[model samples]
Target: MTSRCILQTALLVYFSTTVLAVNYDLLRFQLSSSSVECQNLLLQLNGTTKDCIKDRMNFKFPEEIEKPQQVQKEALLLVTLDIFQKTSDIFRKNLSSTGWNEIIVNNLLEKIHWQIEHLEEILEKIKEEENFTWDDRTLLPLKRYYLRIVRYLKAKVYSICAWKIVRAEMLRSFFFLDKFTNYLPN
Candidate 1:
C-alpha cells in the first residue's frame, strides 16, 4: 500500500508540472508575428507614398532593417525602438520632399507615429501573456484585439495615400489653370 501511494503521488506531481509548463513556442511566435507586423506596416506605408507621389518623388524603404530574431533577448525594447527609428527616418525623408504639401506630409507622419505606438502596445500585450496556451479562451480576445489595431493602421495608411493623390491632382490643376490664364490676352 505504501509503495502504491508513493507511485501515485509521483505521477500526480509529474502531471501537474506538465500541465503548468511554459509554452516557449507561443512566446517565440508572438515575437515573430510582432516583428512581421511592424515590417508589413512600414512596407505598406512606403508603397502608399510611392504610389501617391509616383515619379514625382524619390524614396525607398530600408529593406535591411534588423528583425526580432536579431535582437538580443535582454534588450527587446531597445532593439524594437531602433527598428522604429530606422523606419521613421525613412518616412521623414520621404515626406520632406519639396514636392509634397506640408499639411499632408504632417498628417501622414502623425498617422505613422500613432501606428507605431499601437504596435508597441501590442507587443507589450503579447509579452504579458507569453505563457498562455493557444487554446486558452483569453488568447482569442487578444488576437482579435490586435487584428483590429492592425486593420486600423492599414486603413489609415490607405486613406492618407488616397488623399495625397487627390491633393496633388488639385494642385496640378490649379497651376495649369493659372498658367493658361497668364497666356490669355489681358
Candidate 2:
C-alpha cells in the first residue's frame, strides 16, 4: 500500500539523518588527545612541571571576533600543536648518539619562543575584539592548555639561559684557578 511505502521511507530518512549526526563526544575525545599529545611532546623536550611554573593567568574571549574567526583560530592552534607533536615524535625516534648541536638547539629554542609569542598574540587579539557571550566552556579548556604550554616554554628558556651563565662562570673560574696554580711554586 502507499501508506506502508510512505512510512518506510520516512523511517529510513529519520534513521539515516540520525546516523549522520555529529558525535560530539568523539570530537571531544580527539581534542583531549591532541592536547595530551602536545603536552607530552613538550615534556619530552624538557619542559617538565617541576621546572615550569603553573600560571594563574585567565583568558577572556573578545566580542569583536566573529564566531567563525574564533573557530578558525582555535583550529589553527590545534593543527599547529598536532604538527609539533608529530615532528617531535619523529625527532625522538631518529635521535643520534652525537646529540643535537648547540646551534641547532638554540635555533629550535628561538623558533619555539616565536611560536609561543604568536599564539599569545592571537589570544590577546581575540580577547580585545568582541565580548564572547556564548557558552565559553568549550574554549576555556583550550585556552588553559595553551597557557600551560606557554609557561612551560618560558621555563625552558629561562633554564637554558641560567645553564649558559653557570657554564660560562664555571669556565672562567677554572681558568683563573688554573692561572693561580700555575703561578704557584712547582
Q: Which candidate is the best by lDDT?
A: 1
lDDT for predicted candidate 2 compared with the true structure = 0.38
Q: How many residue pairs clash in each candidate?
A: 0, 5
Alpha-carbon RMSD to native, per candidate:
19.5, 19.9
Residue 88 lDDT in model 2? 34
Q: TM-score of every model?
A: 0.28, 0.31
Worst 10 contiguous positions by lDDT, candidate 1? 57-66
lDDT assessment of candidate 1:
0.40
Off by over 4 Å in 2: 47-186
